[model samples]
Target: MAKKELKKVFNLNSYEWWRNHRRVVTFGLFLSIFAFYLGNPFHKEGKVKDTCAKLNSSFQITGDEAMKKLNLKEIKNYNNRELANYYCERYLGIK
Candidate 1:
């Protein structure tokens, strides 16, 4: 009986299996997306703030000054403050 069931399961087509389990697949996909959104590193403002504080304490400089002093690459789309925040976050591995 077990061998017969195993054969039947193994013989099932991939498309037919997917069609039968569409609700489970959709739920799993939704869960994966929700987890990704909740755990996204780039959205952590507290980390950036903490990194900026650490940079300020260690270097006595603002993010803009640190960007120039470290010779970090400039991103044209971001303003000076945003660029500084990004630099601080990246340089310190906060992101």
Candidate 2:
């Protein structure tokens, strides 16, 4: 009996259960969206810029200077500027 009840609860094609728990589902979805926005997951460039600004103010090193100082391994055929930006983001915990 317990196994049968568990199977019913876990049924994927059960619209009846969804309808009965519409409020809970809606609240969960809203909460998820709110958390996602609150986390600012898409503003990576902004974070990098902020970090670089702080680095510049503290060390007097401009973006160009920092890029020129990067000694990355040329294993992949990636662009130098892009690789430098990625390194800066990772080094400063912006990513």
Candidate 3:
């Protein structure tokens, strides 16, 4: 009687596959995470508004003056919370 021969089609336990593809797979996952972060940073809703409001209440400077200080033409292009944070960091020296 002749014995039938079988070939190994899939190597589930092969670490070589992961070793060879590690960089590519890692980069792809990293790119996906970055894309998700860029699309939705998960900042609280109206955080900019809230920060700006607090700044406005605490500081005597008007919004336009703040814009000028920020070297911006207008507030439309900047995020209020980030701007306020930078402002506080510079003026208040708070970490």
Candidate 4:
């Protein structure tokens, strides 16, 4: 007897499914990754504040002021270390 081909269980492999749920899929993936990183064992929540505070003292500004200077495309999208890196790298012109 010949074996029949198995059908797909879901439409996830279909282009139309992706087209219909592009935003949803993208958002869910983003949230999942964000949550994963948030739960990381060595993640520090105040590195940005500490780094900014230290960097700011050199410029005679406050930590809040340094963060205020950050030109984030979406401020809410970043965590502390990411914000610090971006701010120091881009805003403060640090390497």
Candidate with the greatest TM-score versus the true structure: 1
User: lDDT per model, in order?
Assistant: 0.70, 0.66, 0.60, 0.58
Looking at model 1, residue 63 earns an lDDT score of 60
Candidate 1 ranges beyond 4 A from true positions: 1-12, 60-95
Off by over 4 Å in 4: 1-13, 42-95
Give the per-residue lDDT digits (tens) of candidate 1, residues 19-90: 899999999999999998988776566555565775657556666765665556777876655677667767
What is candidate 2's lDDT per residue for 40-75, written digit by digit as tens? 855755665655664446555644554555545544
Error of 2 at 85 (Å): 14
How should the candidates be ordered by lDDT, best one leading? 1, 2, 3, 4
What are the TM-scores, per candidate, against the unseen true structure? 0.39, 0.35, 0.33, 0.31
User: What would the TM-score be for candidate 1 when compared with the true structure?
Assistant: 0.39
Candidate 3's displacement at residue 74, Å, is 33
Candidate 2: the clashing residue pairs are none
Which of the two, 1 or 4, has more lDDT?
A: 1
Colliding pairs, model 3: none
Evaluated against the true structure, the overall lDDT of model 4 is 0.58
lDDT of 1 at 90: 74
